[model samples]
Target chain A: MKFEIMRDRLLDGLNDVTKAISSKTTIPILTGIKIDVTDNGVLLTGSDADITIQTFIPAEENGDQIINIIETGSIVLQARMFNEIVRKLPTNDVEIEVENEFQTHIRSGKTEFHLIGSDASEYPLLPKIDDENKFEIPADLLKAVIRETVFAVATSESRPVLTGVNWIIENDELICVATDSHRLARRKVKLENLPTDVDSIVIPGKSLNELNKILDETSNPVQIIMSNQQILFKTDHVLFFSRLLEGNYPDTSRLIPTEFKTNITLDGKTLLQAIDRASLVAREDRNNVVRFETLEDNAVKISSNSPEIGKVEEQIPVHSIDGDELVISFSAKYMMEALKAIDGQGQEVIVQFTGAMRPFILRQVNDDSILQLILPVRTY
Target chain B: MKFEIMRDRLLDGLNDVTKAISSKTTIPILTGIKIDVTDNGVLLTGSDADITIQTFIPAEENGDQIINIIETGSIVLQARMFNEIVRKLPTNDVEIEVENEFQTHIRSGKTEFHLIGSDASEYPLLPKIDDENKFEIPADLLKAVIRETVFAVATSESRPVLTGVNWIIENDELICVATDSHRLARRKVKLENLPTDVDSIVIPGKSLNELNKILDETSNPVQIIMSNQQILFKTDHVLFFSRLLEGNYPDTSRLIPTEFKTNITLDGKTLLQAIDRASLVAREDRNNVVRFETLEDNAVKISSNSPEIGKVEEQIPVHSIDGDELVISFSAKYMMEALKAIDGQGQEVIVQFTGAMRPFILRQVNDDSILQLILPVRTY
Candidate 1:
């Protein structure tokens, strides 16, 4: 394999693929990124058994020489070192070549690096996906959905299925749900064009985070293909594939209550700041719980107490109030996460409660598309 | 103590004092910051046995009200929590009140925090300096000197004195030296005013780092007070105190050779990047060493090799060359640190070598105020 590519262009492609390479992977070949040089351009691939990423660099971009492919061949080199060398290389154009013995030579300006490479054939082949099951969504929209719900997934690995976010599609509506049993986050959006079929898939939160990191926030659409056990998201020049978890997701539809005895609407920023102050005291406790008490005339009391770190109480004004007077305790971290996911500046949010013992819901005052629920902590 | 102070002013003072408060200290009271409200203003102090910081918030600053003292008293509160609370408070003016029972109430806007406070009597007293040994230096210059020499101190606790930077004053010139046996850093500055006698002191690197973080890059002067067991730095309204190390610092005067067999001049940035690239390959080896081979006519060859990570070689252009060709291997990290300390962009540095086994020196082309020496690694 032999090619000459721009320094920044190659670094960008390498960074995109490197998200899938893991240093602790048991598969030795998975630690390296595969480089395939063709007459058209060059393709870089990296995987760690769970997820695979492939990025392509074209021959030219904007009338500037991006890649010059001299021969067609393939080789695998260490992902981390390769990325660092290309980034720190002191020239505008870098020349990369692979010998018959797989000794890769990378030269830029006066800097040259010779790396031992492995046979690309040793890497596990990526599974093929049918294009018929693919659907399109804006890259930013997908990233937003992942960021809103992925943090709620259980990360302990004790329940492997709970570590994944459940994606459900019905009647051209897509809903994503993630929960760690203590708290839950769900987001729903209407699909632009979809087939009259229902489908469900559970994707690991880890994979979604990696996808979020690599996906650019552009209007460009990303094509997603789903199979029985794997899913793939393809963008302009990058392909991301991840294995799905097998298990039945809990029926969270029944978990959110339809009626509430009390509802309080308050500015998200004000409430977030109040909770942040309370958290400084509550975080010393195991559950990190803070209590919220609704007062008369659009006022609320926030308080947290730790035996060792003392206590903190804050009064925050609300926008509106109705229904029963309520007092409840929940994780301060969960509340902060819910507030951050809400869109719009200084928008008011309604907190609905069925009872102190049941799970309560937090929703935007004007919209119900995104809902975050937190179970109250029982304090004696 | 009872006072109403500007939120930002109180927060700034709290943050500076909190740097000396360590949660892991065996002395429990050291984790709290003591606050004294007097008729003059408010004084905030924090200490962790090894270091102490005290900052006074005056009644007014630049024709603006900063502190309004209502009562004269004192109390201590958890440093970390107090700093966080003050920063997150929602109002420009914060009201702080201490009850007779030692309960502290901090109110900002509608948010209020009630913290269990400690008796100020339990906190350690500040060290006393009776002697009038004092001098003044520019804050930026002191910060620069600390940054250049502090990184070379030994981190291991086997020799506690080596973890500090030695400061020696002679003939109105302040000389700072630090080393961990493998490498050494020295910086000297001539002062306008001289004390009657010469003096030397060792200040812990950790304390200096904390001081550096709190210093603002202004032309303001920092007054230094040296005593038998402690050193104090007073800048504007803030006072910083650090305990001196007891043992004698090693004499590093003879370690830097005055003459050399080979000397090479190169650009600081170019050499730094080449070493960084070579480090990617050398890191896989046991010693993590990179070699530099001086070539004829203003050229230097840099290379590194590891059995598992392959090899890398690059030629860095130089400004000038002298003496014989030389090949020496050393730690890439140390070399990079020295390069970062150079004051000017595109500055040329002369690297002087005595022998392959001796320590090499790096100095600016026309300035002898700063010097860096690195011991060569045995590559065999």
Candidate 2:
């Protein structure tokens, strides 16, 4: 294989695929990035058994030639070293050639490097998915949905299914939910071109996090294909594949409280800042719990006390307070993360309480599509 | 202690002193910052036993009232927590008051925190250094001196003194040297106001590193006073004290070879980049050794080889090569750091080589104040 390509264009492709490569993988060959050169374009693939990422660089982009092909072949090189070399190359143009016995030569400006390459045939083939079951979502919307719910997934692997976000599609509505038993986040979106064959899938939070980072905020459409064991997210030039978690996700529909004993609407930014200060002392405690109490004249107090670290209290005036006066305690970290995910800053959020021991839900004042629920700590 | 000070002003004082605070210290009290409120201003001090930093925020600066002192007293608060609280306070003006039983009240806007403060009398006292044995150096120059030599200090505690930079002052000349047996960096400056009594001292590299971060790149004079056991660096608003390493510094003067068999002058940046690329492969080897050999027509080749990782070679042209042809190998990391310290980019640097096994020295073509020496590795 021999080709001369623009250093920057090749570097972009390497960066995208390398996100899925792990040097610590037990499968030694998985640590190598497979490169295939053809008359059409160049493809780079990286995988770590659980996730695979492949990016393509076309021979020509727009009116400029991105790659000049001299021959067509394949080889796998050490992903880490190759990426670093390309990044530090001096000139914009780089020439790569695979000589006899898989000896790869990379040359740019006055610098040259020779790396031992493995036969690309040894790389695991990408899982094949019959394109019959696929759906399209705007990249930006998918990123937002992932951000809103992924953090709530359980980090512990005791229940592997809970470590993933559950995606359910029915009646032209796409609902994503993530929970760690202690707290839950749910986001609902209406889909126009919903595929009937695609019903429910569980994607690991780690995969969604990586996919979100790779997706741009552009409204470009991303086609998602689902197989029984693997899911693939395909963009214009990149394909990300993640293995689906096995097992059934818990039914969380009934866990959300529909009735409330007290309700309060307040500026989310103000409440978030106050809770942040309270957490300064609350974080010293095992539960990181902070107390919330309604005061007179549409005001509420946030306080936390650690016997050894002292106490903190802050008062914030709310827009309105209705129903019964209440006091509740919950983890400040959970509240903060939920508020941020909702983009609560500069917006009004309504909190509904269903007694001190029950779970409460928070959502934007007028938006019904997103909900954040947290189980209150048994502290007064 | 009661005072209403601008949050930003107080934060600046906290930041400067907190550089000396380390929670890992065995002395628990050292993790707290001592704040003393007097009629003149507020003083903040933090110590980690080996080093102490104190910053003063005056009541008035240039006719502007920065602090409103309501009462005069002192208290010690957890450095990390207090710094975080002050940083996140909402209002510009913050009120701090000491109530009964060492309960410190910090109030800003609608937020209030009562922290458990400790007795200030229990904090360690700052070392006393007499002003009679003192000299002055520009803050920016001192910072530069530290940067040039500090990285060469031995990190291992086998010879504790080698972990510090040795300073020698005589005949208005200030010379600082640091080495780890394999490589050495030396910088010299001519001082205008030299103190005869202060002949030599060794300041811990860690202390100098912290001091460098706190010192601004300004021409403001820094008064450096040397004592039997401690050295004090006093600025207008901050006082930094560092305990000196007690030991004799080995004489490195004879280690630098004046006679050379080969001499070459080249653009420092070009050579540095070539060496950097070579190090990419060299780093995989235990010694991180890169080979340099003179080539035809004033060109030199930089290369490194790791049997398991392949090889890298680059050729850099020189401005002049007047001496005999030579080949040598050295640590690429040491060479790159030395070049950066000398501000080698966009400047001509002269390299003098005595032989393949002897140490080589690099310096600016016309400047003799800074010299970097690297011992050659036996790799032929």
Candidate 3:
């Protein structure tokens, strides 16, 4: 393969695909990135057996020549070295040429590198999936959904299905739920073009994290297609494919409380700071729990203590409070995560609780697109 | 101890002294920072046995009030946690109040923390040294001298004295030298005040590194005092002490060749880039070595290769070349460090060598303030 492309444009495309490349992969070939050149431009592919990322550089961008193609071929080169070389090249454009075998030469300015390449046929092919259920969503909205729920997924491998986020679609409403049994996060949004019937799929949290990183901040639309076992996300000139986790996801609908005896509204920033201070002392223990006690209708007591690390207590002002006085303890990290996911101009959030042991829910006053739930710790 | 101090000013002072604190120290008290409140102001000290840093926070700076002391006492607190808490406190001012025992209460904003403070008497005392040999140098210039030579010190601890920088005072010139046997760096400066007789001392590389980090980018002069076994650096409000290495530093005066058969001058940035590109391939090997070959009178070739990785070659333009054509190889990391220490805008550096197996010297035209030497590696 012989072709020349702009250094910056090629670096961008290479970076997007490199997110899937694992340096410590058991399969040696999986550590290399496959490059293919054609009349269309160049395509770079990297995969780690679980997810595959492919990015294409077009021949022209904004009516300017980005790639001047002389020949068309394919080869696989070491991902880590290739990326570093491209980034440090001292020129605006890079020329790559592959010879009879798999020896590829890259030239830019006065610098030239001859890299040992592998046969492109050695790379595992991406899983083939029929476009059965396909829908479109704004890239930013999808990124927000992933960010809100993905962090709550179980990180342990004991329960593989629990390590994935559950996506459910019904009547054009898109619901994403993630839980680790200790805590849960759920977000719902109305879809522009929802799938016909009721559908549910579990995508790994790690895959969503990689996808979120590649999604830009633009308002571009992303088309998603799913088969029985795999899902494909296409945006601009890039394609991301992730394998679905097998088995049924737990029924989290029953875990979220439907009623509440007490509700408290407080500024999210103030509560976050109080919890952060408390966590400095609480995180030393096994449970890492922080207690929230309501003294008056407009004030809440936040306190945490550890046998070895001393104790912390603070009074946080609240906008409004009602019903029975409550003192509940839960994971400080979980509460912090839930608070960070709430993004709005107003700093107040309404927290609803059914009982001391029951899972509580947190939501913004006027915005209901996001929801956070935390299971209280039993500290008798 | 009871006092209210401006949070930002106190944090800044603590940061300077905290550089000597080590989290992995075997001595428990070394991990704690000693705070002594006097009528004048507050003094904070942190030490890791090998190096001690003490900084005084005055009652006021410029026109801003810093410390308001109500009681005079001393206490020791965990260095790491105290620094972090002070940095993230949610107030402009912080109040620290201690009871009869060692229970300390720190209040900022609405948050309060009860910490278990230790007795300041338990902490190790910093060494006190008085030396007749003293000199002053610009803070920036002293920082530069340390940066240039410290990197060449032996990091492996195989050679005890080689792990320190040799400071020699002769006539009115202060010279610093460091060598790990493979590479050497030397820096010289003219001083107004010097002892009548010549003197030499070896300070630990790690100590110099921490001292450099603590030095601000001001034009204030730093006083250097040297004794038989210890060296002290005193600033206006900070005092730093470093123990001298016991063994005699090797005499390297004969290692640098005064006459050379080959010489070349090249732009530092251009050579840096060429060496960087060559490093990409060389780093795959055990030594990470790159080779340089002079061509004719105005060009040089840089190259590196690994059997499993690939090969990289680049041409670096030179300002001038004389004597004979030569080829040499050395660690790319060493060359990069040497290039970074030479400060100037588009300056040409003269590199001289006597033979392929001997140490080569690098310097700027008519400037003896800085000199770098690298030992060649045998390629065969």
Candidate 4:
């Protein structure tokens, strides 16, 4: 590939694709980034075996020229080293030229580098899916959904399907659910033009994390297309493709409580802080367990103790409590994370539980878009 | 002990002494912090086998009462957990009361902690260093000296003395030298009340690093007292004790060349950046070797090439060139680090070398307080 491109524009394109590059991949070519220069612009692709990212820089952006294509060609350069070289180049523009042996020369100002490049043809072809099932969503909203639910996904591979966030759609309602048995997080967003053929699909939590980071750097409309086993998230100049899990996700609807014997509302920030203190001495390997109990005075007691270290007790005032006084215990770490995920400007959340041994549900008092559930630990 | 102290004031004391608590220490008591509530104020102490740090909170500071003394007693609490608990307490003041069997109750607002404390007698006493050879230096100046030379100390324990910085005082001048054999860094400062009996000593680089961090957070005079095998640094409310290395530091005077065949000057920042780019393709395990050669046109070519990676070349402008034409190779990593230590305010530095195989010297033109030296690597 031979081209002269603005350093900043090329660097940006390289960075986006770099997120998908696996340095420890078993495939040699996957460790390199394929660069293709054409009359249209310059294209960069990076991929591991499971996911791929491609970014394009047009010949011109807005009214300014971003690339001057002298020759249309392709080559692959070591992703890690090439990115570092590009960042440290001393000029505003970089000229890259690949010679006969695929020895690519990159020059910027008085500095020049000749890199050993691999044949771009060795790179695996990006999977192409029929565009019959696709829908557009604000990139910001998708990022929010991923953040709210992805954290609850199973991190272990014991049940491979649970490692992904389950996406379900019906009647133009986009729902995402993630559960690791002990806790579950679900978020729903209304869709305007939901594709009729699209059904439930499981996308790996890791892939969602990478896509969320990309969306964080941009605010644009993202078109998502789903096929039999692969899904793609495409933005203006970037395309992110991820593989889907094949097995059916477990039924989590029954895991969430339908009725409650006790309901309590408390400020999210106050409860989060109280649990944080109570967990200070709790053993991390023990899940940092903390106990909660309702007092007749309408205040809730949060406490935790480590036999070898110390014990902490906190009396946090609550907005209200109904039904019988309740006592339950759960992982303080999980509770704190749940509270933080629903946390906002003095906002309060209602906790509904059937019994000490049953799973409890937490949700913002007035918002139905997000719900979190945690299975209580038996500690009488 | 029974007392109520401002949370922030107590926290500051805890943080200062907590630096010396070794989390992995074999000595069990070293993992705990000793807290003594005295008639004057509260004192906190933490120690590992090698170093100890103590901090005091006065009853009043700047005419404001910092603590309300109810009784006097002493106890030792687990350092790591107590600090975390103190940081998350819910009130402005924390009330601590020790009852029978060393059961300590800490309360703030409606939150309380019952910590298992050991008898304070189990804690090791801070070594008492004689004050006969004591001298005072501004905390900022000591911190600066540490920063300038500590990086040159040998990181490996193979050469025990090289792992510390050699400190010397004579003729009303204090000079500190450190070297890992391949390179040497020396810094000197004029002493006003030079101790007549003090000659030379070596302080562990790790201890100096910790002291530098403490100094960075405060501005006050630090009195350093050197004894037979220990050193003590004392400030208004803090006392730091560090053991001295027994062996004599190697003489590094001969490592610095007094005359050279090639004397060149360049902009520190420019040479630093050029070397950085050249080292990008160099093998990391081999110190990222880069070559430098003088051109007849008063410019120097900085280049590096790796068979498996690539080649990089840069032409850096020079301020002046003296003596003979030269081509030499050295560790780009060492050169960059040395340059960064001297980098500031677009300064210029002089490079002096005897030949392609001799050790070279770098200094800030006419500034004699600091000097850096590096040995060359022979490359055919």
Candidate 5:
């Protein structure tokens, strides 16, 4: 196999696929990236057994010749070394050729590299999914949904299912939820094209994080297909596949409180900054807890006390306070993260407190699409 | 004590002094920053026993009132926490007051913090240095000298003296040298006014690193005073004191060879890029060895080989190659760093090779102010 391609075009394809390659994979061949040069384009594939990524570079892009193919074949080279070499190549044009016994030669400018390549036949086959059960969504919207909910997924593996974000689609509405039990993030979006058979699936938070990074903010459509065990997100030039968690996700619909004893509307940024200061002292405690109390004149007092360190209190004015006077304590980190996520949408945030011992919900003042719930700590 | 000072001005002082404060210090008081409110200004000091930094913020600067001092006293607060609180305060002006029981109150806008302060009298006293043994150098030049040599200092503490940079002053010339025995970096500058009694001193690499970060790139004069056990660096508003290492530095004067068999001149940036690419494959080897061989017509071949992985070779053009043809191998990392340091000054670099086993020297083509030496590895 021999081909000369534009260096930047090849580099872009390599960067996209290399994200799925892992050096820690037990399957040795999984650490290698597979390259196939066909008549139309060049395809690159990388996998780590759980996730696979494939990117393709067409021979011609916008009437510009991107690749000149002398022959067509396949080979798998070390992903990391190959990527680094391509990144540092001096010239814009690179030539790659595969000799007898899979000896791959890469040249650019006056620099040349000879890497021992493995036979492409040894690579594991990627799981196949039918395109019949697929739905399309804008790339930016999907990215936003992932960002709003992915951070709440449990990091620990004690309960394996909780390490993923649960996705449910029904009645043309798609809901994404992530919870570590202490806090939960939920985002719902209305969709026109829905897959009827796909009811629910739990995708590892790690997968969504990688996908979010790869997905551009453009409004281009991304087609998603779901199989029995594998899910694939297909963009214009790249295909991303991730394996689904085996266990059933816990039902979190009932965990959110609908009734509230007190409600307050305040600027998300102001409260975020105040809690950040209070957290300076509370961070020394095991729970990182801070107290919040409603006051007269549409204001709230936020404070944290540590006998060994000191105490901090800040009075933040709110837009309005109604229902009842209340005091509650919760993890400052949880509150801060929730406030940050809400602050991304709008400045005004409405916080509803059920009681001192129950969970509280924080959402945009007029938008119910995104909700952040935090369980209070009994600091008394 | 009570004072209201501009938040940014106080933050600048805190940032400078906090470089010396370490929470891991065995002496608890060393972890706290001592603040003294005097009629003239506010003094902030932080010390980790080995090094101390003090910065003063005057009451007025450029005819603007920077601080309003209501009273005068002193107290010690936790360095890390206080710095964070000040960084996040909302208002431009911050009020600090200490009560009779050492209860420190910090207020800005609607936020307030009460920290448990300690008596400043318990802080260790800084050693006094005589002004008779002092010299002044431009801050930018000093920072450049440190950057060029500090990276070559030995990181291992087995030979404590080698972990420091040796500064020698003689006949109005200041010479700085650092080496880990395998590689060495030396820089020299001529000065008009020099101290007569001060001969040589070894300053810890760690101390120089911190001082380099604190020093800004300006032509302002920095006064350096050498004492028996401590060295003081005095700037306009900051005083930095560091303890000297107690040991004799080895004489590296004889290690640098004046005679050479092969000389090659090349662009520093081009060689650096080529070496960076070659190191991609050589990095896996124990010594990170890359081979350099002179070619006909003022060209050289740079190559690295790892039997298990691959091989890389690049031909780099040079302006001229004089003397006998030579083949030598050295650590790619050392060569790259030396080239980078030289690239900071000029693009033209002259490389002198004595033999295959002898150390080689690299320096600017027309300047002798800085020199780098690297010992070759025996591959055969």
Candidate 6:
């Protein structure tokens, strides 16, 4: 492969693809970035068996020449060293050439680096994900959904399926839910202009995090294509492909209670701050458990006690409270995270609970698209 | 302590002392911060066996009443939890009352924390350091000296004495030197209006790092009291005490060669950048070694080659070269660090070499107050 590419463009591509390249991967070839010079542009691919990321640099972008391809060829270079070389190459323009023996030469301004490359054929071929079940979502919207729901996914692999965020699409609406049995986060968004059949896919939480990282600062629409086993998110110049988990995601629709005897609207930030203060002592305990109680006259209390350490009690003023006088205990960390995930959307959180033993729900005051729920612990 | 202290003032004091509180300390009480409310002010002390940091909050400062003394008492509270509580308190003024039973109640706004406090009598007492050998230095200058020399201290504990920085005081001048045998860093400064006999002290590098962190933003003069077994640094509000190393520091004067067969002056930033780029390839090698050669003209070349990887060669333009043609190899990491420490002094680096295998010297151009030496490797 021979090409002269813009430094910033190549650096951006390298950083994007590098997210998928893992140093601990067992496959030796997966540790390298596959570079191919094509007629349209130069394609850089990085994969770690679980996810694959590819970024393309066209011959020209935004009326500026981005890459001038001299020949069409491919080579896999060590991702980390290659990334460092391209980023610190001391020039605005970079020229790369691969010899017949897989020797890659990268030159920029006053610096040049030659790297030993591997044959591209040694890399595992990425599975083809047909566009049969394709959809479109604004990059920012998808990023927001992932940010709002991915944090609740179970980090433990005991259940395996709970480590992923389940995506369900029906009637041009998309809903993503992630739960760790103790707490859950769900977000829904209406799709636009794409006609597709109902589908369900569980994507690993880690892959969603990488997708969110790459989508940062870009507002372009992202085209998503789902095959039987793989899902692809194609952004402006990047294609991110992640393998779908093979399992039945536990049905969570029946988990959220629709009928609530109590509903309290509270300032999201104030309650978050109160819980935060209580957690100062709660963290010393293994469970990080804090108790919340509804008070009279639009007031509530949050407290945590640790016998060896101390106890913290905070009173938070709410906008309105009409809930059956209740006392519930749950993880202070979980509640804080859920509140923060929905706190800054220009709305307070409306909390609803059936009783102290059932799972409680927190919804944005006026927004019905996002909901977070937590099961109370038996701390009596 | 039973007092109402300004949250900001108390927070600052807590942060200062918390630096010396190590969670992993063997002494159980060392994980707690001792709070003493006296007639003059409230003093907070935190110590691990090696270092103790005490910060005092006066009852009043600059016409502002910072603390309202309700009663005089002492208690030891868990450092980590107390620090977090004070920082996250919900009021400008914090009211802390210690019950007779060692139960402490911290009240701020509508939030309160009750912590099980330990008896202050269990905490280690601060050492008594006589002013017999005391001097003062500007905090900024001392901080700069520490930053320049601490990085060169030996990390390996094989030679315990080399793991500390040796401070030599004589003729109203203070000299600090640190070396790991492979490279050495020395910095010196003249004292003003301070009379003291010649003295030398060796302080652990880790203690110096902690001292640097506490001196992060303040620029006041700091009083230094050197006792037989301890050194005390007293600022306006914080008193930092560190145990001194007992063994004698090595005499390193004979290691720096005075005669030079080659002398080259180069821009510090440029040389640093070239070396940094070269290190990207050299890092994979066990030694992280890079080669430096003096060119015929006003130029120098830095290159590193990895057999499995490729080689990188860069010619760094120098201001002047007046020495025998020379080639030497040294640890790129050490050279980069030394160059960086000397780079931002608004001056270039003057390199002096005795021979290919001799210890070479790097000094700030036109300034002899600071000097760095590196021993060359016999690379075949």
Quote the positional error of residue B154 for candidate 1 in Å: 2.2
lDDT tens digits, residue span A173-233, model 6: 7989999999999998988755465378899999999999888556778998987688999
* Listed models, DockQ each: 0.74, 0.89, 0.75, 0.90, 0.86, 0.77
lDDT (Cα, 0-100) at B362 in candidate 6: 96
Clashes of each: 0, 0, 0, 0, 0, 0
Docking class of 3: medium
Clashing pairs in 5: none
Q: What is the TM-score of each candidate against the true structure?
A: 0.96, 0.99, 0.97, 0.97, 0.97, 0.96
For candidate 1, the TM-score is 0.96
TM-score of chain B of each: 0.96, 0.98, 0.95, 0.97, 0.97, 0.96
lDDT of 5 by residue, A1-380 (tens): 99999999999999999999999999988889999999998999999888899999999989988999999999999899899989999999999999987999999999999999999999999987988889999999999899889999999999999999999997989999999999999999999889889799999999999999899999999999997799999999999999999888999999999989999999898899999999999998888999999999999999999998999999999999989899999999999988877763338999999889999999999899999999999976
Q: What is the lDDT of candidate 3?
A: 0.89
Per-residue lDDT tens digits for candidate 1, residues A325-344, read 88888899999998888752
The positional error of residue B48 in candidate 2, measured at the CA in angstroms, is 0.9
Clashing residue pairs in candidate 1, if any?
A: none
lDDT of model 3 at residue B318?
93
lDDT of 2 by residue, A16-96 (tens): 999999889998889899999999889999999888999999999888888999999999999999999999998999999
By summed lDDT, the worst window of 10 consecutive residues in model 4 chain A runs over A279-288
Per-residue lDDT of B315 in model 1: 86
Q: For model 2, give the TM-score of chain B.
A: 0.98
* Candidate number with the higher DockQ (1 or 6): 6
TM-score of chain B of 4: 0.97
TM-score of chain B of 5: 0.97
lDDT of 3 by residue, B1-380 (tens): 89999898888889889898889999998899899999989999989888888999987778777899989899998887787778777897899988978898889988898888899988887666767877788898899899989999999888899999999888888889999998899999998988754388899999999999888878899998888888889889889988899988888888888999898888888898889899999999999999999986499999999998889998888988988889999999989888887753378888898888888988886687899999989998
In order, what are the TM-scores of chain A for the candidates?
Answer: 0.96, 0.98, 0.97, 0.97, 0.97, 0.95
**How big is the positional error of residue A261 in model 5, measured in Å on the Cα after superposition?**
1.6
Worst 10 residues of 2 chain B by lDDT: B125-134
Candidate 2 - CAPRI tier? high
- The lDDT of each candidate is 0.88, 0.94, 0.89, 0.89, 0.93, 0.88
Worst 10 residues of 6 chain A by lDDT: A190-199
